[model samples]
Target: MTAQDHHSTDLQRNLTNRHLQLIAIGGAIGTGLFMGSGKTISLAGPSILIIYMIIGTMVFFLMRALGEMLLSNLNYKSFVDMAYDLLGPGVGFYVGWTYWLGWVFVGMADLTAVVSYLTFWLPAGASFSPIDQALISAGCVIFLLLLNLLTVKLFGEVEFWFAIIKIVAIIALIIAGAYMVATHYTSPGGSVASISNIWSHGGMFPNGVNGFLAGFQIAIFAFIGVELVGTTAAETKDPTKNLPKAVNSIPVRVILFYVLSLVVVMSVTPWTEVKADRSPFVELFLMAGIPTAAVIMNLVVLSSVMSSMNSGIFSTSRMMFGLSRDAQAPKMMSFLTKSGVPANGLLFSCACIMGGSLLQYFVPNTIEAFTLAGTLCTILFISVWIIILLCYIRYRKSRPELHTASSFKMPGGVFMSYVVIIFFVFTIGILSLEDDTRRSLVVSPIWLLVLAIGYFGFYKPRIKNQNTPTKKF
Candidate 1:
């Protein structure tokens, strides 16, 4: 069999360099930057800029480690496959399911965001009730299911256009904000556009150590999908060339889309005046006296959530496919359609997402539901990242020959892996200090316990049968 056939049993390697580039871009930018930045800025003041830089740098290291292993073996599909080979079957199974759960909650959160944004256009009364929103959320889940079922290329195509809209919107906002600052124009809120706004209002770290740490809670979530490009290792064409380029460009995306954009936002308006609940993008345009500021911003924000939800579905289905191939999940999930799409896996993931909408329908308090769900997602995602770092460390020691032979090596090597791992542990410790997020830290252990049970109880028995014979009689 050819290398392509040996590597991908069902998934087609149809995603080109263009698709990989856009997927990387889409993964880096999320609704969190557009909407949640207002709150993060309020929490951390001008210091939020530094917060993004720190997190972005660490994530780039994690991606480098992942890319190294992925390129080490062309037959290896994702981190899931690498974990199976280097860290043993247990690590692979655990990471695979937790990763799926992480994205499932992310999709749930974005689904709620979709409904909330839709309320902007609808009348506030019976036209926008909980039932109405639930139905709309279900419709969105169905739409994503259909889109993903078509083909991997189509999934990449949708993400490409969605990412373009975000890229264009941010570039335009930055330009407008720069102009207002250059002219020293005043906003309707009476705040003047000046670079001094970053430090003038209570200095950079307005909220002190406590507030600076608080910003990490939400800002970290913004970077949740940055590792998504790693998941596309199987479908990507010319992964060696395309994957590294996609991974290396993350630092640029972070600087431009995140740091520069936020600098412009806070510079145009004082950090203290920014509303925690509203999007800074909309507020910035409104400050510049744009006629359709609300409509334009709403459309862009809608696209942001749609992009996130689409990615959530894609990643979750792929994870399920990996899990099933290893016999860690339902065997049916491994079945693929003629187009090389994992239709069963896609359908199962959407079913779970629809359940998120139902939770919103039954639960009267949306904010509480969102907080609990978001916290769980943060915990699970952190675990997945830690697993990737840990697997990289194991790969270095267990397969020294591979490391010595590789062209693209992780910059810091094993020492950097330890540093990143310690950093992640510290972040978890920080999460425990907050009342809102502490519960997730407490609840996450239960998930690990359950995965342990599933691994021993189900997947272990099938491992011997799954592996090939080493010697012929």
Candidate 2:
């Protein structure tokens, strides 16, 4: 094994094998695969499956790279700690803060989904009233806040079930789709659809390259929490053993959950016929002439939101704890509760949710609200990944021994890391072109600027003597 003394110091490995398993599964499947796959299908046609598979391949390597780094040494508490050790404290500051913001933006978007799902009980246009929306959104936030404030085990347990529901929903959908294919049951609309429907309409990229490219825009976000499995390593009980299981199975699961699921959906219903603005999976049942598809999908999406929010709470708190331990955040955040959970940090994040939920209620439309928030989420997440690549480059140079001895080393060594970084930059450039995402493109750089200011404003001043070893957090 590689020497752990070079990295981890403060992280206590408290997460269990089960927690790691559920967390990784939840990360692979997002709300998008459940709800937004239709849009991907519309843009890319059945070729959306191709887009998902390609994104999965790239994301798998990124997670594998992260696992290798975290497992390189026991001294490494988390990725931010590794960044500090290998790339110096400046990169750590940026990575640590940028990572936290990624979840915040994500959390806000998930919260929006929760409110949207709640509208199922209300009259059609009821959500249009700001006062009504505010009260209900606040109530939803409070429900999640309570869930988060409980024991981490409880949170993990809930996520386990949430993930199970999502998994089951997909399995049922796939099974139903398979039966229809085998029996050659025609759609109620009197259309005889078959697996050939995937190709016959547009021959995969029927909508053209623009559709395929647009599919990437959505596919990338589906892969957002790909690295989150690493955060739980410190909390994860028996991480060395369990982490491998979760991390290694990622490729197979992504292919099954995304590629296979979409193939089935498109086969059951033509990609061209799937709803573009709403969920495709549910639409398949709806189009199959099932009356209860909307209700069933409502439950599925609700689980997706809860899972995302629950994860958001867990990950953001860990980031805060890491930052405070390293003096990037207030010290109180570093302290843990009796259950070994960072109680205060969790509450602070929940508080941020309340603040944002209030803003979302006042926003014009839920889609408008989510688009704005999702854009910022994408920016912060993109920045966080970029910093990871940057840190890995320095990691290879500064700690050659770890690089050489590492288990599950990132493929492509330092070169591919740079390549991924360039891809991320290009994504930013594309975001700059779209009216919806352009504003977030403008705002995201300010976070980097603020971190630069904070480093100079706070942490850098404390590192007065280069020769004197600083506190290794």
Candidate 3:
């Protein structure tokens, strides 16, 4: 066999179509959807549904472009691989590190959220100190780290069940909401829970153009993990077939999990009635007279947060592995266990999460820390998406033969690339309008500056040395 053929066996293709399907579903339905939907509904009223659909549409095209490029060269593992080849090493290094940090922070945020959720069951008074929560969060991370270090299939199995919980919860919520609306059940507040609640509260765009724009801030975060499916390219059993099927189902998942769920929520409880500080899912169950609403929603959300952390770990480990192969990170990170898991990278990522957990423990304001980390994550994710689009554009031009020969060509091709890029720009501009979100806009430039310094100061010199031949040799 050829040397390349032998090396291909290093990453075992153990992820079946089933794993890909649910990972896609779980990735699309994030903690943001559960935690932030209440605020989004209050912000945009019924127009939030439109906002979700718009973002979902743009992301669909973006995934297709990524999938097409991935399929074009089976050697490519993730978007970073595409950037390294189509763009330059500088683009690759920047995008890779940014994406890694994005997940690192995501893992951090979810780790904190998990601790907060766990504290609900803690006995009040002295037993519920921040130390206890930190320990609990650390334990949970350790459990996930151990499970992930087992095998790729194990990670897939865990995600599959986590996704099943989320799906069933959403489906059950929709059914219950539909039943309440059909019977014209009135909430405890005496407002008739009807489909009209969507528009009855000061019409569809209740807050006008500005309120509608406000929805984008939270709604965009809801879709943060949607591109996670793209990260599974290397482990997938059949990328050409399974990848396309997973990509095609994104819109369906978004509609069902996001749009439909929100519609049912607002219909059962008016948008204005939904509390910004609480989950709408819990609110709906409580309004329907379920005494265990908080407990039930807590369990579901805990699972959702765990799932997000799981995905973050998986993506970050894989990213570090790719970076090591490119000589952009410590070579030890590229080593794999007998089961094809990146053990060193996994441990390194878990260590970072542990540090963030300590930060969450010391910080008196958990919300502020969450906001800062989440905004940083969103900005970095957006940057990576823009890079993917740019790489796709470059792929089309530099390899017209491959573009034309490929079966899964992006529908609008390069034109759609520009369209999505512009949409991202519009979203960034919208961030500037909000006082709370504007900090993300201001801080984003500093992040770019750090990345520039890292790439030039560290990666550039080593890359030049590695590429150059020694005269003595």
Candidate 4:
């Protein structure tokens, strides 16, 4: 390829080790952890800690499988590419568009979240109307679009600082909670802080087995974007070194960010006292007598949501660009700016994301819309992870030489893949146990039916007539 052709077709490798490292951390920590943990704690009490650990372990294994496949063939851009090569073009098209729609839902949730967070700074008894909220959501989408259109490295820098703010907030919470426990600090509610607070509330199983299972419904959504690091493979400076380093640190990130932070919160304010409707992080600071706790945590959580939205924009655009290149999407989506940014894909995704704001007008109840979007996103993400594992199983069997010669092979190989698949099946079963999530489960088939109509009715026939092989990355 000539210089111009190369610039037009290939993504720039501008992301360094630091960028990838923090992006990995940012992907693992979601707004769900900050905003939804209180509800999880309320449902399952101290058992929520064990819930996070279990989900985190399974996610780590999934990432390991993704990392191995990505390294095994550097030509592969993302898991989408792996599916295309190992599976068939039909499955590849489905995975690509399904993953794209999943991020679109996530972007919608984040957009709504940003609007809600902005309302936190309003004066008492003041509020934003639906129109006002929609405008604000549009403004955020435009700002992020402009930033992303600059260059790939700029996106990395944006995520780097955003992830830094999140890390600082969590670390601060953990430190303050530990001090409160050591000093036996007493809140105005007369609840004394102690290590025993976690268990003493209800002997660790206050809500029983049913409550413990219910925790998985929300906790699994907290880890939705954990595979985001794989999306950065094409733009990363050195996949061989950086990818493994990021994947290997999953256990520590889970422990420090999820497990440890929750433990600290419960230890400071007993699980029974954590409010279901509010953020435990903010409540923790409030219990510690920080007058500005609400404002500070509002800012932190706002940044966290934006970081996630930014990742959504970046991932969805890249996936669309890749699909377009393979003739599965519009040709215009494959167009890149001089800086190697996929401007067309970015604009398209931002347009869809703006629909979230419009929901404020139509749906009227933003929380319900957000929940529906989140549930659908969780279902689709789990499906994608399962597809990735199937790709890994195929890789091991068809290319034993690659697996044998590989440096970062998945532990336990195919056996482990089957185990994780069963775990996800159980997780999906858990989703049906709740009304809100079950509603989403029932609605998910409509999307699959749409994909089927597009594929068999339109895409398959078009490709068969062309009689040309799909382009390999």
TM-score between candidate 2 and the true structure: 0.91
How do the predictions measure up, each by TM-score?
0.94, 0.91, 0.93, 0.96
lDDT string, candidate 2, 97-178, tens digits: 8888788777777766666666665675665466666676667667877876666777778888888988888888888888
Q: Could you give candidate 1's per-residue lDDT for residues 386-455 as a string of tens digits?
A: 9899989998988899999998899999999999888887777878767878887787889878988888
True-structure RMSD, every candidate: 3.4, 4.7, 3.7, 2.0
Q: Give residue 284's lDDT in candidate 4 (0 to 100).
A: 82
- The C-alpha lDDT values of all candidates are 0.84, 0.74, 0.84, 0.87
lDDT of 3: 0.84
Q: What is the Cα-based TM-score of model 3?
A: 0.93
Error of 2 at 460 (Å): 2.8
Shift in Å, residue 282, candidate 1: 1.7
Per-residue lDDT, model 1, residue 122, is 62
Candidate 1: global Cα-lDDT?
0.84
Q: Rank all candidate structures by their TM-score, best first, as comma-separated numbers.
A: 4, 1, 3, 2
Candidate 4 off by > 4 Å: 1-7, 123-127, 364-366, 470-473
